[model samples]
Target: MAADTTEWKIKKLIQDLKDQYSKTVRNNPDTVAQIESAVRILSFLVAGRFENGEILSELIYSASNLLVFLNDSVFKAASKYVSKVVNVTKEKIKRWLTVLEYTEVFLEMAAKKKWGTKGAWIVITIIQIMKTALRFYVLVKLDGGIGSTPAIQPVDREILKTAEDEHDNLEDAWDEEAAYSAQEKTFTLQSSGRQIRTLQAAEPGMRTWGVPESGTQSPQNSVLNRKRKMLNQPASKLTKQRKWAEGLHIARPMAHLISMYISGLDSWKPFLLACGMDVTSMYLMGDTKDLNAKEKAELKRRNMMLLYYLMRSPFYDKYTKMRFIAIFRFIAQYVPLSGFIIRPLLEYLPTWQRMYFYVWTL
Candidate 1:
């Protein structure tokens, strides 16, 4: 063969790694579940970043969903066909979950629309209700839901990625002239070129195997604990009353939209009602001991989301909007040239508050 190329070697190495990884994922059922769970959560969070770059938001959301689909459905199906070792029930639930994710981008886009008469509100409402219902059956009844799922936390990566490169140079990193002079003066039969070549060798390390490693079982303990919590979750603990409270909590957006369309509730009532429902659900979900690790985390999240309502309407219009307008006007008085910039933002504030602001945060 002609001399091997860098690009070709890299491609071959990548393909080999991919094949090995696929086989490992297939052989280990736990890895499959872990990957699927990660993909679902990633897809869920991918749409949260929507600033001036809305199109990028759509692309990332779609890409995350594609990852979810591949892990949840395609990979498992292929694994089952090839190895005949797969968790069929879990795979089926994952497939359904993958299908639910298909609407992620569409729902997010609709939620951001400024037009109330365009029917996005009603469509989003219905979709949320139906999706939640199926999510319960598929996620809880069939598979380990969010609680049993493990999340991968990034450690040191941000610091590492941003850190300046550190180096201790020897003859290796010098210019060709300096490097060649540093090398051995022994003559060789090979033709010399202008640039010096570095030799490649296998990485130096000892990878001892066959002996079971310590700390491996600790992770399994966490997973088992989650499963045990799910199994031992008493019906009394999560009663119909609590369920109803959660239902009201989740239906907050739907009710908010419906009330606005009907022209019944005052401008502020919907937001307050939703806020109250959120509080009620939080109360009903109970203390740290009562709720699992996941629910506790979720409760904390909702608590944080309470701050979101400040940017929402009636609150925004009566309180925030007026304050902002006054500030802009006050600044414009001192700085006359600033009105050209501030005027458009002041005008767009109401529309953004109603349509984009709250939904974008979601």
Candidate 2:
């Protein structure tokens, strides 16, 4: 039953991705952009690996940037949705472009040792600078742009109900599947806020969020109730501290990016400024007493995501790579045949990941 629930979740995840991709495709009506994409794909088929596919890729990206000459209609589909959700906005697309740009450089370096010495670092620096500027704009212009991003389209309640039904089905299946000796096989009911859960006598009582066990509470049902409550609750306003913390947190990246962009900035200056802002912001927002339980968790999560900055320029190249290497080595130590499986990957994965990480922010 657990396996079935997991399978259902995986399928749902895939379906959601497909739906989003399709929506993007449907909304994109730019003929020139479509042609450019097609040409790039066809060129890749012929010379993607050869010459590192850099020239065509660069031309396409430049053409895209220059496409401001085209009619606004080309951007109409996406423009209407602009400001609706930052995730679907032009900034996200540009961030992806930065990733693609760096990826090509990574490919160039990984393929030919000679190519590695020739201008790849310059290309990577340029990508990072461009992406950081974009992030700075999004953070300041958008409302601290904090919190979990909602979907492009609001989800229907019916779909949620269906999912809840599946969860309930899984709960029922667990009761049927629990193994027990005949002496301990008696059926028992566990009250879990919204509904009674049928559980096996052999199953031990479980608790959630300090909801007392009292030998009758069901963990799974409690989880369902919490989820339902979260969904049903009305949206709440940010507390003064939360708003201030978010503002400062948003300012952290801005300060970092601004320092880089500014001339004559000395070493470790931007680093200090960014770190200082982050610590201050975390302290302010960490006071979740004024916010609801859910708000507190979300605030903390957003605070954690701020660590993505650690993966950015200067810091990533200087410090984070070592940490990643140490962590990877620790994990690989336990897995059998990891050395053989990871040997090929070790050479190029870091190069690819460096280029890829920025796109993950959105």
Candidate 3:
């Protein structure tokens, strides 16, 4: 009886997806390709085989293609129901773009190293699955009832449980990274070819803030030398002072020793870049600004240091991770594109209720 019920549910899900795909195809022939791609992704998920490059490639392409379509239509619909989902608008598509960009870079790196087909598939599968899972969660929520009680033979709690678990893991990872970053005083710097450069620590109006002079030096020295000199400060004091001074330092390639110790900073760099902000600059300019000249860069060196860690902090704890997901979920729920636009039609709902409805419809 249980087996029959489970089989029935799976069949129903597949049928619903096919129906939706057919409807989408009829209304927008241009989107048929994306719908097909989504179908392929679901197929891979159902099969539980991660080694197929052809399938993975198709999944990535379909995901990338649907980003634009989803962003324009479905995402808008979701937003109507969940407005504060993510701070960034259109994050469903943004997340897709993030995965696409990372996948391209990963593939290039894999190709350069002459990674075996299996190896390439392994890497791509991880990224593709992670991306798809996120999209699936949002969709399930958008459709309503990935969480709704099980009236007709409850869905696999494990699927939702695993997602919640992954979400928790990500949060915990973020928190752990944040804690480590705080104590480690991590800073991110840009690497040019072999040289890593960071902001100089010279006081405003003083020359020599992080620029290398005309002396040839080892690559390590080029980066290490950029750090503010202690100027004969004693050893015991050097350790104490460096800790205090780290936050004030800007744009300097993070110390090799420090960077090596704090692995989280490495991954956080891409995430920061995605948000269009430089980690080092934000660290140095407590409150980042575009100043022409003479503007005292609001240098809250210590605060900047703390903020770096805070940004990297893990969403490990269950509640903490849920909070993060809830944020995105809220935003996904609120958009004009997804559901009925009744703000003008029904003005009686309270402000919060109206906002809630708007997000839910999206």
Candidate 4:
């Protein structure tokens, strides 16, 4: 895995590249710098440095393919399967909420461009978006599954074929020891060598379970006894229930707070207006014709409304609240001194005593 800071730097670089690429593509259709930046970013992404790299790459590639299909009027108008495929693709893509969604949306516009006119520029933008999204996705997946012990799977020959297809230079890189030195660290033993070996154990019939083999209990019986002893520990169902109840209570209030804040008349209008720029940036390559003043104004108005409602959406209301409360609970649980302070207040104590404690702390 890449260092957290290195991953972040890569993401930042990709984002900057995309921002510049978008501006350049819009201003100068003849400029080829965007394509170079995009290809570099895509190469990094396809190199698959991070843990969730494969999943991220697959989703990005699928989304890019779908976007290309969507933009091509010939494909869209030709078949019922195309429309069905697009809907299915959207649903599948929605499973990933963070960077993937943003990348998918970005690609949606690029896919909308006319086939012959600056389509390559749009494809480059798609590549840049995928790179940025993949870095963030990898970060999130690693953080979430940090402590998990992933079960090993049987090696698939198809992996090598897929890599070869994705990158023209991969075949040569596989031969060069220096090129694969870093990759060797990431590859599991199960996925690497042709030969597999494991130590053989004694037959099951030789291992008696319930009865003693000679004078003492059998090895299998001893193992069972130890497992029984381990299982006879106290369980805390009440404590678990209390924690869950508190989390649910906190979440409801947090959702209302977020909804109220986001939907408020004060700052929401400006936020919506600001998001229009982002929407415009993403969809700049979508239409074949240059967006005239009227088209631009209309797009801004429609998209601002879309952004405002999206932010204030019921889905976001609950989601935003859940995320906030989750963080709050994580802090409350993991922060050492805060638990000491909060525990007394959380307990079934008198209101006056709580007030007095708060006053003392202050």
Candidate 5:
């Protein structure tokens, strides 16, 4: 009787939460639509017993729709309900396992969807939830409560094949190593009861190898001498200029391409804009003499805008912000006294409170 009463109370609580959620969604037709879609998708999953290709397809479509609804408001409300239910439940392990399963399935579906930048946040959130559930499971086990281990499901084979195809395409796109290998021929020849190895340089004008001096020298000493000679040779002015131009040619276009790709992302617009502003500032600093007063004013306005955006963006975590700082620090080496820009950006980085607390405990 007691067990039956407990189960009834839990069901009543869940129903009450559902009722509250329904009331909240009533005013927002979009939320209602999203919830309905989720219910339909979940029904297929439950009805098919989490198997069958047709059901998985429906689940994937629904999961994609859910990703679109994973904004701050929706996520917060869902999190609050989950937290409250977890707090009130005696079957913590069962609740956590359900969450873990749902998160894993959603992540798998999201991966199959291949939504790129739009799905990044959804993937991150699901991974975080999985981590939390795993932690909870560990704690439960440590308390001598044995819970059923979650089974790992295989990801769709088509998704794996798609990833492999992408990798192959990337390899084909960047085949410089193959081209260089094809140009240079290294061969071993056997003649007069001795084997001779021939080395060929990749560059057209460079010699393959230098003849050793008419003296007994160890192989290590010979290698050191060759390296020292190569290092001592001064580069020609034209060669240096050509190398510099080649570097700029590679870096500038690549930077612009990256900026363009990142700027197109809804979540990354501010960061991309700030990066563009920094690049513009770098160019202005490089060639200040050519700039008119109006251009200088425009640069200042851009710098201010960049600062504002950097201050506003809370999307970046501590590590990401640190990496950005490191990049700017590297750029500072080329630009004269860029601390004016870099220092302010560094100051806006997330605080290390958690890190400090961990270190204090240690």
Candidate 6:
């Protein structure tokens, strides 16, 4: 009976997808091609044709691209009732799609450009696609039961239980710490007040003057005496103080090492280049009152050359390559000619990769 219900749900999902496609994307040939590619890829997956990691990777990548295309085209036009039922909005779906497409382009560039070989590209692409698909699938499946049984399973219950337990533990610990600190503070204040009163009662003669004599052993005078005694002590007695200062000096280098590890100082060049490209692309495509036509042309020329150099550079990692692709996609949306210039070089990329560029440029 459960098997039958699951089958029914899958069938309904497919029918709904078909209906959406017909309504929004049936008129576009390019969109039809994307749909066909997605269907073919999914069919392969269902048939267990993805026997190896490479094929499995391609299938997952294709699925992601398909999902993105559907979200942007079909789901974007979905009715409020349908969208609410699915618990997904057009804008939300678009953002996810953008991220997937950005990632896809990045991997594609990393594989083809950085590696400089089709075989290397295919391997890297497959690994990245698999990783991303697994992450997204786990998140969606665990969070909302997407394409799964709606009833909370034992695993889901355990996850919820763990989260609740952690939250309760944290709350309890904080409350206990706060209460202890408050009590300690109150006790200290009471002890200090009692000490002040005892000293005032014992020295009635000094209380009338409103000031303690310089020689009097008041709290302030005691603190000064302690400091003076410490400063005058032999070097052997100050071993702990010297050790503490040495530790602080050592911590400076340790902190620098930690900062380097966290900030990835060695990888800063690629990060900087990515940021520069993104900024430059935005400026060229955006309204700029500061630059004349000649200046803009000169900047555009330099920008194009820099983009080409980065695309051909082998030094960039997959993440850096993705940033470049994202920047290009953004620029291509405003400057159609930019897409044409790079089309020939990227002809060897997958259909989905090419389609992504075409879709944005269009």
TM-score of each: 0.46, 0.44, 0.21, 0.15, 0.19, 0.23
Q: What is the lDDT of residue 65 in candidate 3?
A: 42
Off-target runs (Cα >4 Å) in candidate 3 are: 1-40, 43-279, 288-362
Give per-residue CA lDDT, model 5, range 249-347, as digits (tens): 223323433554566433455455445544553443443344443334444554454443333333344234566767888877678879766664455
**Per-residue lDDT of model 6, residues 51-115, tens digit only:** 44333445455555555455444422432212222334423533453444434544553455446
Which residue ranges in model 6 land beyond 4 Å of their true spot? 1-88, 95-99, 102-162, 181-277, 281-362
Off by over 4 Å in 5: 1-90, 117-129, 132-144, 151-362
Local accuracy by lDDT, each model: 0.49, 0.49, 0.35, 0.36, 0.41, 0.40
Candidate 1 per-residue C-alpha lDDT over 154-242 given as tens digits, one digit per residue, 9 for 90 to 100: 11111111112311121223233233331332223367433332232111242322222222333323444455344333223455665
**How does candidate 4 fare on TM-score?**
0.15
Rank list by TM-score: 1, 2, 6, 3, 5, 4
Mind giving the per-residue lDDT tens digits that candidate 3 earns over 57-102? 4346445444434433332232222223432333444455454443
How far in Å is the alpha carbon of 263 misplaced in model 3?
14
Query: Per-candidate RMSD vs. true structure?
Result: 17.2, 14.4, 27.2, 25.6, 25.3, 26.3
Residue runs of model 1 more than 4 Å from their true location after superposition: 1-57, 65-116, 135-237, 264-266, 321-362
Provide the global lDDT of candidate 3 against the true structure: 0.35
Listed per model in order, the count of residue pairs whose N, CA or C atoms clash below 3 Å is 0, 0, 52, 0, 0, 0
Better of 5 and 6 by lDDT: 5
- Estimate the lDDT of model 2: 0.49
Question: How do the residues 1-362 of candidate 2 rate in per-residue lDDT, one tens digit apiece?
Answer: 99999999999999998667545543443554566457555643443455645445444544443332231222322332222333446436444544444344433344334455345544444554554555445444543233332211122222233333555686666555443333243333456343233343324554222222233435565555565455434335656676676667545544665675573233567767777777787787664675555556666676676687666556666888788777767667877888665554455455445443232332
Q: Whose TM-score is higher: candidate 5's or candidate 6's?
A: 6
Worst 10 residues of 2 by lDDT: 150-159
